[model samples]
Target: MTLLSVDNLSKSFGGLMAVNDVTFEVESGSIVGLIGPNGAGKTTVFNLITGNYQPNTGTVLFDGQNLVGLPTHTIVEKGIARTFQTIRLFQNMTVLENVLAGAHCRMRAGCIAAMLRTPAQRREEEEAMRQAMGELEFVGLGKEWQNKAKNLSYGNQRLLEIARALATKPKLIVLDEPAGGMNDQETQELITLIRAIQDRGITVLLIEHDMGLVMRVCSSLVVLEHGAKIASGTPAEIQSNPRVIEAYLGADSE
Candidate 1:
């Protein structure tokens, strides 16, 4: 049950290769981690998968369809939603408004329908509002629906990004460095939220440097170094892998 299959994916900026012939598969209903030290091209691989960048070689298949040249919005429409390594939120927008923006892809109302206040458009708007609130509640921000995005604490801001992505109704959500700026308590909460997401039957593929969080949540892991995949396996296997230790995890991983 592979939901995503990335084969021989490579991307280069000028002469420098950001990602090189990396291949990985994310199974449906599993939480997968992409790990490495900074500059290992983990985020670059994410960009390639989500259609922000086109790979120079190879194919990205989501549900058996190629996504190499699709626009980013089209990729989202195809059931793949992503968050940035840096939290990308509409800071000035209300929490609910931010989530509603993510629902735009699934919305069918055109400008004419919206302007004319057609019955179909009204129903769609109501449904989007309902979905947005549900996602906010799922992420523990239900009470803050009217708060501006910038008003949330740093960790909650991250959760808000996840909620927004969820509003897209994606089969797979790509999270880039989701635990980048969180304290221990917040990270623990994040671990719970991630598992809850999997419980909903959605697959998650994340780039995270937080090894503890990665180990706790992910059933499988792919390690990268120097823009290529070095090793991939279960947490226990990756923890004991010598090459992974030497490349990124270091001697203290044990």
Candidate 2:
């Protein structure tokens, strides 16, 4: 089943086209990789999907609802959550506090209810805390819940970001360059975490340059170059695709 359908999507910045007529679908309960070399517009496609940028043409359908003009928070409420290419944790905030922030979208208490300490608000707050802690534990940061986000090691910081995104209770999570700054061990752990996320029945869509990681985790891939989709298929098919090879390696390479 298609949880997300992006059709005829195109975006441009002034005169330069960042993404052009790209399309792909993310099936429910699958890990899909959107991959390309730098400047190939992989992130642009992500931005379009998550409502950060409006495309000049095309439609983004999430569970059959169009997401194009919706605000970012609305999109989150509609079950799509995303992380940035650069880690976007609240550095000064406690790790638990950071996760709680992600849960804010699902929270229903208004300022009046919160200020008055209504019974409903209290119950919601308790539930939010419980959910936040669970996400932290799931990402292996349960013991560091009280530490400031900046105190975590670089790789642990990445896990914290994922934990926070999970707190949103999204059906689909969009991860941008999730393995960008990790060592081999950290990357391996990430592979496991990603699989665990899929195991929990959340669809994962990611933009990653780490080919090995992409091949290992993604059931299918969408390849891009020069702001357009060049090819998309299983890992084995992409590996044998001459166009994908030429895009990553120079055409002159033997």
Candidate 3:
């Protein structure tokens, strides 16, 4: 099933057309990669889908609902969540607290209940902590639950970001440059984690520059150049695509 669709999406900043007539759909339980050279409008498309920016033109449908005018938190509550190209975590908070914050949408304890510390509210808070810990385990960070998010190694911090996003209970997850700055071994671990995520029935929309990671993890890919789609296909097809080669790989011999 197509869980999300973008038709003829366009965005501009002043005179620069950042994303022009770009379109794609993400099927339920599938991984779709969006790739491009620098300034190819990949992240811009992500922002549009997540309601960070209003599209200049076109439609964005998430779970058959138009996402154009919805606020960011509303979009998240609708079962979409995303991580940034740069890791955004609460540096001062414990790893578990960050994940608990992601679970805010599902929390049932209101202000009065929380302030009163009623039995029901206490149970709700305990359940939220349990759920957050489960998410931490899912991302292989359960042991770091008490540590400050900023104190972890860079790789662990990235994984923590994914864990926190997962805590939001999204049906679809968008990852931006997930493997960026990782060494070969770390990338291998990332490949495994990404597959595990997809296996859990959450559709993944990936924006990545590491061709290696993209080829290994993505079942399908959309290549963009100057805000327009230039090519899209399986990894094998993308490898042979002349337009992708010219736009992303240039004249350098393969």
Highest TM-score model number: 1
Q: Tens digits of per-residue lDDT for model 1 on 7-34?
A: 9999999998889999999999999999
Please state the error at residue 38 of candidate 2 in Å.
0.4
- Which of candidates 1 and 2 reaches a greater TM-score? 1
Off by over 4 Å in 2: 249-254
Which digits, one per residue and each the tens of the lDDT, describe model 2 over residues 1-254?
99999999999999988998999999999999998889999998989999989999999999999999999999999888888898998999999999999998899999999999999999999999999999999999999999999999988888988988999999999999888898999999999999999999999999998888998999999999989999999988888889988887345433
Residues 1-254, model 3: lDDT tens digits: 89999999999999999999998888899999999999999999999999999999999998899999999999999999898898999999999999998987777779999899999998988988999999999988999999999998888888888988898899999999988877888889999999999998999999988888888899999999999999888987988888888889555524
**Residue pairs with clashing backbones, model 1:** none
Model 1 C-alpha lDDT versus the unseen true structure: 0.95
Ordered list by lDDT, greatest first: 1, 2, 3
Off by over 4 Å in 3: 250-254
Which candidate tops lDDT?
1
Q: Which is superior by lDDT, 1 or 3?
A: 1
TM-score of each: 0.99, 0.97, 0.96
